[model samples]
Target: MLTLLHTADWHLGAQLQGWPREAEHRKALRALVALAAERRVDAVIVAGDIFDSLNPSAEAQKLLYDTLKELRAALPAATIVLLAGNHDPAGRIEAPRALFDLVNVAGVGTIARKDGEIDAGVHLLPLRGAGGAIEAHLLAAPYPRAADLPILDGASEGSPVVRSVRALYAELIAAARARIGAAPLVVTGHLHVAGGLESEGAERRILVGGEHAVPSDVFPEDIAYVALGHLHRPQSVGRECVRYSGSLFPLSKTEIDYNHGVTIVAIEGAATTIEHVPLPRPTPCLRIPPRGGLARENVEAALAALGLGPATPADDKPFVHLTVAADGPIVGLDAEIDAIAEKFPIRLASLTVERPPRRETEAPAPAALRLSERQPVELFREAFALTHKSEPTSEHMTLFHAAAAEE
Candidate 1:
């Protein structure tokens, strides 16, 4: 049997409303390390979005490396695989490849291929059981672009981008099978499977352009499991064998209530068992006015009801996402809402001021006149009317038009 733990989209260094999320990210990783120790899993897979940005801060880098080190310490015999997501810089993640090797870990950021095929020797690793025997093989396939796919070189085949991706996976899966033909397969990926559920406001829409979301049938039917990333909502695509472990925390207001955590997959022969292990939410995300827009009067009351404001300690401050009611005309009143939040013990992530619906607006007075939409004739008329205290004469207008035509 193979015991595996799947997690993704850490997005370290992410912030809400300009406030740094380093602390929450650190806490989540720490909990994972502890969970790994307790679960006694044989392999751990992290599917992309490791850092919030390509060029991560020094603190985020330190935190990632430090957390991986701790995870290694906690599970010396277990294999750890970290793949790159769309947000990660391939070179950055690949730079520390050697450092991770000392602790039985595999890290991949870019899908670098040579000679029309990926060097499987680096991406495919052995999944061992408690008895020090190989139970399965893990294909650490990270985010791949058109350039990442191998050149077929006159091989007659359908050439859609998704087909190319499927071919790439086939090559990797076949390569792993060559080493151990009978063992189950566990594939790690950072991809969007078609029909997968997404956190509405949390994830980027189509991280991979044009042919981004491939059909879940891309993987062969016989494969034991497919561990995927990119979509923050944890769900299975097409079959239970393929799944997304989701993100570590609520990256935005839309993901505020996600059961954010890791997944444990147990595979024996052809059977598999999947379990979701929810992680601890170090800080709560509070939406001011709960169901409506941000109101100055409700800010303190909402905070107090959430055990925040004067009652909550600074260390446990919640993330505040304020919004103006949709039915009102409160678009320009953001400053007042901001001032109200400033009085509470909260990390102000955003203030969404709702604007009333648009209506036909009348042209402004002379002082507010804009020149972009004004014709030269109209501009001249306005100038003449203003300077002479009267509209321009027909002869003057004719002259202006004649001069305008000549120019």
Candidate 2:
């Protein structure tokens, strides 16, 4: 049996509303190291989005390097593969290939070509078991870029980009099959697949140009398993063998309820079994009123009911999103809420005010404004007219001027 761990979307060095998430990342990496050691897997595949930014901080790079060293030490015989996602700098991820090879680490940031044809050697790696014999073949594919895809002779049926993406994978898979004969082929991708659930505001749209999603049929039936990334939620797309292990932790308000974890894949002969091993959430994400918005007058009570007190350690404090009902514009509301939050140990990430729906007696909605006629002041005026049914007061214009100046 060939046992492997599949994980992705680390997004290291990410911050939530100005709060650094290094502490949470550290905890997740530690747990991952422990899990790999405990499972004694033959390989570990990190699909993509290793870092939140293309140019990661020195501290973020240090965390990644340290974790790689730990994983290598714990699983000396296992192969560790890393692929670059849309969020990662393709060249930067593979820049340290020389050093990575010393510890049995393989990474693919971009596709390579030789003599105008895809280079198979650079993308294929043989998985060796304890006996030092090849078990399965792993095709380390990364996020496809426009430059990496083949130029078709004529316009294809669906979106050109989608067709190119499918072509790219098909070519790579064919190359792998030709080279390895019929050995169980495992593949890695960092694009959004059709039918995969996405966390809004967390994952970026990667399928660029014409279509935003690539059909899961891109992978052939002969493949043993397909490890994917670029989505924050753990899910199987089209088939049971194709899966996304999901992010190590919640990265945004929309991702708070995700079962953040890694995946375990065991392939024996012709049978394959998959399992999800969830990681612990270090800090809690709390909504002030849980279900709905609370009235402005009761907002303080709702916050207090969370059992929060004075500020705790920055890393330990829970992140809170507060929503309060507004009968009309409340005077000094932000200042009042900030004051109330000062008495709690949580991090107030966002504040939203819910207004009652417009009555039927109000004027009908305004016609759509042309994009060419969009001046900052004119757009603001249109928005204010729609909401208040009146022109902006001089005072409102002054505030708008101040805000616009900052922008």
Candidate 3:
């Protein structure tokens, strides 16, 4: 039996609303390592997006290495594969190749090629069990720039990029199948699959702009499993064999609905079985009054309905997003909410005021603003008035206008 742990989109060192997530991430990584140890898996695959930013903080880098070290220590015989996602700086991710090799951890960021050809030797890996027996073949397909998969002039069926991507994978899979010779096949990648669900707010929209999503048929049906990344919500493509493991934790408020976790895959011969293990939630992420905001009185009444009696420990406080309607008087609004919030054992992560329309025919809010056509000072004045509930003084206007003029 060949059991594997599939997880991705760690986004290590990610910050939400300018709040550092190192502590949460540290706990989560350690938890994953412990989980792997408990499961006694033969392989672990991290699809991609290891760091939140291309230039991650030193602390984030250390956490990743430490997590890998701990996982390896706990599961000495397992093969751990870490690939790069769109957010990763491929070169930086693969920089410690020699060191990783020494520790029995494999890392692939940029696609490896030899003399203008996809180098199967580097991309295709044979998974070995504790008895030194080959269990499966893995194709590590990292996030590819246009340069990685060059298009060829030939009989084509899909868009150039899609054709290119499909061609690349087909070649690698074919190579892997030939090399491994009748073993369970696992393909790992970081891309937006056609039917995958996305986490709305901050999860990177991998298919933004002109780029299109690849159809589910991109991978062969015979493959045992297709592990994916890029999307923050866990979901399968068109079939059960292809799947995304999702991010380790909710990265944005919109992602609260995500049943965050990892997948434990058990493969025997060519058959594959997957179990999604949901993570524990010590603190909750909630958007009060789901549809939208409510009137001040209504909001208070809703809070009362929650019936939270007293404040809890700081670490146990839930992240809250409060939205209130404010067409009428907003006097003592924050104070009133604060009193109610104090009773709820939740941190007010955000407070949004929904204002009623000024007039039935009020000019539609422009979809976007063009600062080049207007003076910067004017924009500042408008924003200041709305935020501070008063017009800017002459001194403020002069200082701001002068600064804008310099630009």
Candidate 1: regions farther than 4 A off: 112-114, 151-159, 205-208, 294-296, 309-315, 326-328, 354-407
The digit string of per-residue lDDT tens for model 1 on 8-87 reads 99998888767888888878889999999998899999999998898889998899889888987888899988898888
lDDT of 3 by residue, 65-177 (tens): 89988998999889999999988878878899899888778889987888876788788877876677887878988986776776679786656777777887887787787
In candidate 3, stretches whose alpha carbon ends up further than 4 angstroms from where it belongs are 154-158, 207-209, 297-315, 327-346, 353-407
User: Residues 114-166, candidate 2, lDDT per residue (tens digit)?
Assistant: 88777898899998766677889899999887788877778657888888888
Comparison by TM-score, 2 against 3, better one: 2
In model 1, what is the error at residue 304, expressed in angstroms?
A: 3.2
Candidate 1 backbone collisions, by pair: 17-349, 293-324, 293-325, 294-323
Off by over 4 Å in 2: 309-311, 359-363, 366-407
Instruction: Using TM-score as the measure, name the better of candidate 1 and candidate 2.
Output: 2
- Candidate 3: Cα lDDT at 294: 81
In terms of lDDT, the poorest run of 10 residues in model 2 is 382-391
Error of 2 at 319 (Å): 0.9
Q: Please report how far candidate 2 places residue 174 from its true position, in Å.
A: 1.2
Candidate 1, backbone clash total: 4
